[model samples]
Target: MSSENRTAGSGRLLTGLAWAVLLLGLWLWGREITDGSESGSSAPTTGDVAAVGRPPGVALPAAHKPLKPAKPQRVDVPSIGVTAPVVARGLDTQGAIEPPPYETPHTVGWYGNGIEPGAPGTALFVGHVDTETKPAVFYGLSAAKPGERIRVTRADGTIAVFTIDDVQVFKRDRFDAQKAYGPRDKSRAELRLITCGGAFDRKTRGYTANVVVSAYLTGVAEPRAG
Candidate 1:
């Protein structure tokens, strides 16, 4: 096994999500569907903000119509140099969506029980920011800026392309799962990528905040040839 496959410490990347689940009821009421438009505003000035809006002067593409429900086979964030396979994951006993196993830090975990990627709802994807000995697939997720692209290749062979609209790092104390995980627009297909962020707290055995990157479906590519 490579160094990236080494077991992580007791501090799991899902600690922030688990804490959110405890405080906000997570998938229950916290997953409330909401509607809104993409505002071309400046990013949040502070790391504690619940949600960041698109930076000014960044013209993002118009949203593409939602596609048929299809499982995501892979995810690629070119700006961050991320390209990883996606696997279905369910909520843990604590009600928090489980992340990819420590042994597979390069993989991303999709919420299998929720809306599929490219569908008309918010699709959630989670991954580790780093393993015990190295950075994982989403380690550079926080550096992803608005207007960048996130491509999710679906099992149907089509690639659902999403344009980043917001990126926020919510402090654990102020984390709002509803606003952070909920759909920004009910009419458009949205996606959320989450990972641990901020300073790691040895006392708590976790990070101090959660980085949530928001994007909406803006384009679709034909199935790649085998």
Candidate 2:
């Protein structure tokens, strides 16, 4: 993880779709200790304000220790013909992960700060569905449906296959935190791919909502010897 927190910058990037799984107390205490700023009456924004500080009425859920996935280093969606190398870097000082070349046309992998991709908990993977001018990596992602396969090729050459469970679109302002970040049955692992969706919002330079595809791990394979 990098010593410098990157949220101040990336937060602005995913202004439409933001999530914070880390406990609220940890967030508030960290802010006080690191920035020396007293808490204020800041209403939750469309994005995850859980990152900024704990919201007044929302109490952080009980923490659940995450079971690390096999460490997915590559992302491949054969259904939509997506093959991209993953990048590992602390997206923000708060410990949320960042995807690679996010500002570019193609990149895949977990944002390092949040749950690890393929991990037991809900792992978040995000990409631009479409840029302001060009088609982006996940532009076709909305077409993927339940039962489609999403594979992650690890650095070690192993691959994990996950079956898509559901896909839905949500208005940015009405995005449900619990549905996006709340804890779930840990017996089975889940994955979430989020990207800008719906219409473009000229006022905010953000999408009107987000398209999310949820999947569950079905298989894991070790690197094959050549």
Candidate 3:
């Protein structure tokens, strides 16, 4: 094979391998959630600092009725000062969800195969915590506390307003994918924002834990008049 062809093939192989490892981790997490046999505890943290969980007396809003499915166009978290464009992402050839390209670290990847942002299911979104040189879009995700709002603008010209209820950091060794990704209430439109958390491991070239922020639709905003 020519040098260019060889490089292309090698790149594909590496991508496939990375996805395979991710799929394996998810499978293990699902099993742990289902069977409840995992023994490790996951400390809640973000970027090496302790995260704020739902404190006593902090009441969140009730869930709003699920809206018609629409693709997400953008996501905004005012508390953490995040405003990023959302891009539809699908499963790789290995059936694992693909993340946004490293070149576009500011973009968020929505799992297009899952429920839409305003639909009555958990809509999954992922972002990079940091790149080799700088913090990425969700670098401060762990600092978000319960009762904050997450606004998602959809293609239908409506905004889905969600209230944060949970922030957790699951250790990669004992991550629970079902608990992290599954809808907290099947009747409510929920959203999950995930990124790498805890400390970065030099040996593995990855983070020690995954930061998951859980929120549910609590209100809706009509599109602004043109």
- Please tell me which predicted candidate would have the highest lDDT against the true structure: 1
Give lDDT tens digits, candidate 1, residues 155-213: 89899999999998878777676777877888999998887777655567666777889
Could you give the candidate ranking by lDDT, starting with the highest? 1, 3, 2
Cα RMSD (angstroms) for every candidate in the order listed: 5.5, 11.6, 8.3
The TM-score of candidate 2 is 0.65
TM-score to true structure, per model = 0.84, 0.65, 0.80
Among the numbered candidates, top TM-score falls to: 1
- Best first by TM-score, ranked: 1, 3, 2
Off by over 4 Å in 2: 1-68, 93-99, 222-226
- Encode model 3's per-residue lDDT on 124-185: one tens digit a residue: 88887665545678878888889999999999999999999998876666665567776788
lDDT of 2 at 131: 36
Off by over 4 Å in 1: 1-9, 12-25, 29-47, 50-53
Cα error, residue 71 of model 1, in Å, equals: 0.5
Candidate 1 lowest-lDDT run of ten: 33-42
Write down the lDDT that model 2 would get: 0.54
Per-residue lDDT tens digits for candidate 2, residues 1-226, read: 1112112233333444333222222443454421212210111234432222223554322222333445667787889778776665444556444434547557754645445555665666776554334456777776676667787775555576777766666556665645554335565566777665655444565555566677777776666688
- Quantify how close model 1 is to the true structure by its C-alpha RMSD in Å: 5.5
